[model samples]
Target: MTLIDLTPAPAATARANALPVAIIGAGPIGLAAAARLTERDIPFVVLEKGESAGAAIREWGHTRLFSPWEHLVDDAAVRLLGASGWQAPAAGRAPSGRELVDEYVAPLSAHPAIAPHLRTGVEVLAVTREGMDRTRTAGRSRAPFALRLRLADGTIVDETASAVIDASGTWGQANPLGSGGLAPLGWDAVADRVAPALPDVLGADRERFAGRHTTVVGAGHSAANTLIALASLARDEPGTRVTWLIRNAAAARISTGGDELEGRGALGARLERLVADGRVEVLDRFEILRAEPAGDGVRLHGRRAGEAAAHDTDLVVAATGFRPDLGMLRELRLELDDIVEAPRRLAPLIDPNVHSCGTVSPHGYRELAHPEQGFFIVGMKSYGRAPTFLLKTGYEQVRSVVAWLAGDAASAGRVELTLPATGVCSTSAGGCC
Candidate 1:
């Protein structure tokens, strides 16, 4: 892929250099971009909607990551952290979400070079050219970006930047539990009974799940993690019952790489033991059609195979995955695929339908470019609805994008990434987590 011409006209380049490159979200990918910019001596600012860095990761802090420390840490971040005498975590050790934030994200955000440019509790509502919308084309590349932000204290703020990098992730926009990718009937009315995808079953949310009959929907690893946790809860509280629901005819969707995989393989093995011991009931080929309020809990109506079937449960966990939020960029020019919603050029490379190995080739500024110059959507949000995103892939994306922004065309064009191969492909034909 060819890198776009990042250098502006002589007059525009002068003006652009005076302004800071505004980055949205303070997650790992966003912070890594900041570290790269710092190394290049580029002026930039980071805006996070949450009260602190890695705010989204904190929601599922109890869950351990499938990748180890070697795959999770970015090179630029390590260089910056190493200068401050920061010790790295054990190379082979896998960290929980909380530990990742506390050890890596928090320290990176506190670095002198990055800390001064970071701003938390600031939500970017919209992004557009200073005086032009998506319709205009002339001089659009030269104009600075205008951002509409919502502050923490119920106040609105307007900010401008030479360039905008949207690293905002897709954690909050979860897929629905209903069949055909739509919300089930009476879903909102019975919303109170539904549990978050990755709840702290054995910790803070123990009371809500103990002694309750719960059904987990989805065939991804998130579902596996929740099912394992529920089994542990059932062991302690004998009254607690757990059921797993999936649309596939067989449980082969669980791809266990055996000894080939590291942290993820161990999780797959634990889930296999649970299935063998009959601790968690697996209902395959079950498609949810509707959900209705029944007594204190909810009754789920669906079809098992071709016939009709239903299940009444006290709670449901929707681990169906998430989609990117494109509402904020309506006014900005973008080229997205119809199905995956990722950048047009990137969809073909990462689409689960075309590539089912759960591994995507490395992509950089070339694949991430949009019609609007100096604007990029990176990290998990760049993958749209695809679940094949890895932290290693996201780090490579920022490294290349930042190099281009800093006028290092050759560096930006050379994209390389190394990912652990999954021996088994996903049986459901959907991207793997």
Candidate 2:
């Protein structure tokens, strides 16, 4: 790894004179904040729990973003990367998550302006107000915040900052799978008898699934991905049979960059193709009730949509989505939404009237319309219930907040670009749809 230290030549005494700003999470949003701070000449340090920029993106790096490159990349990010002579992907192309991290995020991190201040693998466990301490700024003394951080190596460090922003994204929580994400007869009954978790990508546990029938549930992107991956495996593993259960009569398509899946979007299209080949059993609008060990496999009891009678199946999977985990914030004195437990509102400008020192709203987009003060939340963790548009929203929020921090009120507002209205999938044939 190349390390370039850009700290001023002045002694440590002089270096500690500047006010600090704490930014958590180094995804696209955090990079935006760093870029804005660089342009404004603000002295700040960014803390990222991940090993590098967009670590979350790296986890699903093989997948494609639902939005086009234009929506994924922000203006501030483009400016920084441009200074280093980096060319961006074509405007409307949907890049894979890995591509977004590499071409867009990595270059921004290498920028001299933002690079020096970013400390990777540093997770912020908590942020609290420090008592007043007068410090000379220009000619008078001013108060600044004292930040507390817990690094990945279990090191605890404290520093002073004037502001804080959160770009942690939705990677923090898991959406509930309904009924504890297991068939009602109890998963333990079939736990030793079924395939392993995420088996499509990881490969089924042959001892448990060979010559066995299985069922999967849900209608979201993740569910689609798992089903498609499994279908491909079935081509060679003929002894395995698979069934897909959807609560809705039809699955919704996940669209991006003029692409659409025939069954819905790309995933829906893939599933449709799988169905055509007799590779999967499609049970639309089926609600599961229970499951139990029945001879060789498990018996899953559920009612089909509009059907008064119950039905049976061999194995079941819960593919429902996730929600924000408020366990960490339980001690903080902040308002939460009744339904999702996310912050209620956030202002673009950091005014004390809008938010307290340590909180963020659940719906991050709302923060663009009404800014929050002191506390800022970025990345997917801030997206709460809606993660489909997380990348676009996170990019905008950081740009707006950093601009306001630099005292540029004109920069805060709704994004001007219109999201692509094309079908969820197209002839372009992007994978991980």
Candidate 3:
């Protein structure tokens, strides 16, 4: 059966009475919000900066998730998937990024709950109040926030919504490898050699390193996946040397999912084995001070966390981290948290007293909403400097925002969903499920 009607033409005029909600980021969390909103019969639209669900996943398609399928499965996400007859794999293993996106995120977006509202290739630049609506902008009126978006095609559209959710992941911005600025010491004369955002593990440019020395920095899952993938190509491509430079004495590894070792848990073990096999060199607790020009390549200078000795490398891949873009909110009159610029207090259900999705920290949710009633930050960016809770937080935000918009303060306070514990995948074989 067709979940949505489409005859290649617009249908007859119908009252556009549904409440408008705009979700930024089409990843798991954004899609999940779409699903939840759809289930509640809420009318909304999803704007994805990337071309598809899990673009970051597609970038690292060769890599497996740190969490297993069970942990990966958000309750709402699973229900939507099930409705489409998408059976959960039984082995309970962590699937690769591609598999997770294709089988889960992409499929879920197509579900009846979210399909009509899913719009890809749209990048949300900012969320602010509607013009002349200072009452809502200042928290005095119950008007929703206005969203200013720039699509991939360069189209600028201003849309008003009862709420705004930001699910854009930390992966969008790459934390630079240099401190203060590009290391002033080495390669300063030819800084162009540095590729700010290096290609993802499966990026085409990665192929040029086939028979050369390469150094990878940072210790997150992205870095982990890159090391493993490069190691796998060693046998097929001779003279391919790998060096891992992490600040930790030993890599921090997290095993994820099922009885099978395919998740982050498995990758950690695999990395250890690769280290033992002498396929990759591990440089723990060191830092790069500068990249000095050396004959043909660059010599990297740095000291260990405690030691003063420096190190060297031919190529560097920094997987530091990311930060959010506050371009749209820069000039807004709303109060911003000193750190993250997110509304200090956000009560999605429209209640003036309740700040449901403010800060998920020891301080609880801060009062970022100010006196303004309609403004809200609904996704990962909402967390600001807070340790990102990932998709779970976004899901919670939307639930509260929807309730708040519906003017049910009591219901917003009562809205809570339990997330699955991490690990527990259905496929554990080969650790690349």
Which candidate gets the maximum lDDT versus the true structure? 1
**1-433, model 3: which lDDT tens digit per residue?**
1122111111211232334667777877678777777666667888887887777657656555545566565667777678768897654565776888887888887786777787888777767655544333233243445677787789999877655556675555655566543543645653544443334534566676677677887665556666787787677788888888776787543233342333445666777788899888988887666677665555666677766766555566665545556665554445655654455553232221222112232111123233334445555455453322334445665665555545556645554755343312212111112
Summed backbone clashes in each candidate are: 0, 37, 38
Q: How do the residues 1-433 of candidate 2 rate in per-residue lDDT, one tens digit apiece?
A: 1121211121222333366667877877788888877778878888888889878667656555555676567777788788778888898677766788788888887788888888998866655444432222231112344566788789898776666676666553444333444445565666664442234343334344445566776666666666776676666676777788777777653332234323335556666788778888887877666667787666666667656444455655545554554443332234444543344443322222242111222232335221113445555445345433334445556766666565555554435434343322211111122
lDDT of 1 by residue, 394-430 (tens): 8889999888888788888887666667422211112
Query: At residue 113, what lDDT does model 2 achieve?
Result: 86
Clashing pairs in 1: none
- Ranking, lDDT, top scorer first: 1, 3, 2
Local distance difference test values of all predictions, in order: 0.83, 0.56, 0.57
Quote the positional error of residue 25 for candidate 3 in Å: 0.9
RMSD of 3: 9.1
Return the TM-score for each candidate structure: 0.93, 0.70, 0.73
The candidate maximizing TM-score is: 1
